[model samples]
Target: MKLHGYFRSSAAYRVRIALNLKGVPYEHATVHLLKGEHRTEAWRARHPQGRVPALETDEGAFLIQSPAILEWIEERWPRPPLLPEDALERARVRAVCAIVACDIHPLNNLATLGWLKERLGADQAAVDAWYAHWITEGFAAIERLLAPGPYAFGETPGMADLHIVPQVFNARRFSVPLEAFPRIRAVDEACAAHPAFAAAAPENQPDAA
Candidate 1:
């Protein structure tokens, strides 16, 4: 399996964490998003949407979108489960994941930020504010939903942890004040200590600037 991704991409970062936690060995294909590599013809042929973290599965299948890829990872390797066994618990965990995946990340990803500056004629300060606002709002909700533990959903580093840790990494990059979200901070800190999450960090990736 080969995972095509960029070091600083939050979407790719989540997938890397999941693969590592499952102890799945795979190759990494660096997509330099900053250099517009994802927009090139080659990348477009490989991924129609031209997004990072496009996983070439062991069966020669290509997977896109972090959420679907995450679900596939959990299903393929069920040992160290990334989700809870109970149906109710699984729904709860999925909701927390959506808070980051659906609500927060889409608003603050590289494309949207670039659009704010280039297309909309917004300055750096305005872009920074845009990033911080969504992060703060979404984090407040996540902080409330999080379990009181080392990880997002109790002691294990599951699906929720995979999504939370990467988004927090992005938040810190934007200098978003996290003092208001202690539970989210605690989860970030705890996941940092875990080998899987630590290895999957953006800076730890080979393509990191």
Candidate 2:
């Protein structure tokens, strides 16, 4: 398997953590998003969406989108499971993941920030404000939802951890104050101590600037 990704992408970062936790061995292929490599026609042919973190499986199947790719990773590598066995517990965990993946991440992603700058004439201060507003709103809900634990849902990191850790990275990147979200910061600290999360960090990746 070969994982195509950009070092700083939160979506790509989640998949890296997932694979490491699952103990799956795969090659890493860097797609230089900053250089517009993903926008080239050749890359578009391989991945219609031209996004990072596309997993090329051993069977040569390409998996796109971090959420779907994450689900597939869990299904493909079930041991040390990222989800709980109980149905309701799974939903609760997934809801935490959604808070980051659905509500927070999309609004602050590169394209959205780029559009804010180029299309809407948003200056740095305005862009940072927009980024912090969404993060504060979504993280408040996540803080309430988080379990009193070393991870988002329980003693061990799971799907929720995979999602939140990356967003926390993004939060710090934008200078968003996390003092209001102690639970979220605690989870970040806890995850930092774990090897899987450590190895998947942006600065630890091959292509990190």
Candidate 3:
């Protein structure tokens, strides 16, 4: 399997964590988002939206969208499950993951930021402010929903924990203040220390150019 992704992309980061947690060995294909490689005709043919994390499965199927890719991973390899067995618990975890992926992440994606700069003439300071604002708001809700212990759900770093960690990584990159979100910070720190999470980090990726 080949995973097409940018090292710094949060969406790709989630997939990386999922792959590592599942102990899936796959070759990394670097798509340099900063260089606008994702928008190229070749990449667009594979992924209509020209996004990172278009996973070519071992069976030769292309899976796009981080959430869909994550669900696919969990379903294909059920051992050490990333989701809960109960439907209600699964829904709760999915809710938290969706909040970050659908609502907060889309608003802060590269295309959205670029549109703000190119179309709206948003200055660097304003753009940075916009990014941090969403991070703060998102973290506030996440902190509330998170359990008091290290990981978001409990001892294991499940789906919600995986999604939360990457968003916090982005939050720190954009200089969002995190002191207010102690619970969120605790869970992030714990996950960062785990081998799977550590190995899948952006800086640790081989193609972090």
Index of the highest-lDDT prediction: 2
Which 10 consecutive positions of candidate 1 have the poorest summed lDDT?
Answer: 200-209
Q: Which stretches of candidate 3 lie over 4 Å from their true place?
A: none
lDDT of 1 by residue, 2-59 (tens): 9999989999999999999999988899999989999999999988887787999989
Estimate, for each residue in 1-209, the C-alpha lDDT of model 3 and write its tens digit.
Answer: 99999899999999999999999998999999988999999999999999988899988999999999999999999989998889988898888898899889999999999999999999999999999988888878887887657788888899998899999999998889999999988999999899999999999999876
| TM-score of model number 1 | 0.98
Better-scoring candidate (lDDT), 2 or 3: 2
Per-residue error (Å), model 2, residue 82: 0.3
C-alpha-based local distance difference test score of model 3: 0.91
True-structure RMSD, every candidate = 0.9, 0.8, 0.8
Q: Over the stretch 1-209, how does candidate 2's per-residue lDDT look in tens digits?
A: 99999999999999999999999987889999999899889999999977787999999899999999999999988999999999999999999999899999989988889999999999999999999999999999999998879898889999999999999999998889999999999999999999999999999988889
TM-score of 3: 0.98
What's the count of clashing pairs in each model shown?
0, 0, 0
> What TM-score goes with each of the models?
0.98, 0.98, 0.98
The reply for model 1, stretches above 4 Å from the true place, is none
**Deviating ranges (above 4 Å) for candidate 2:** none
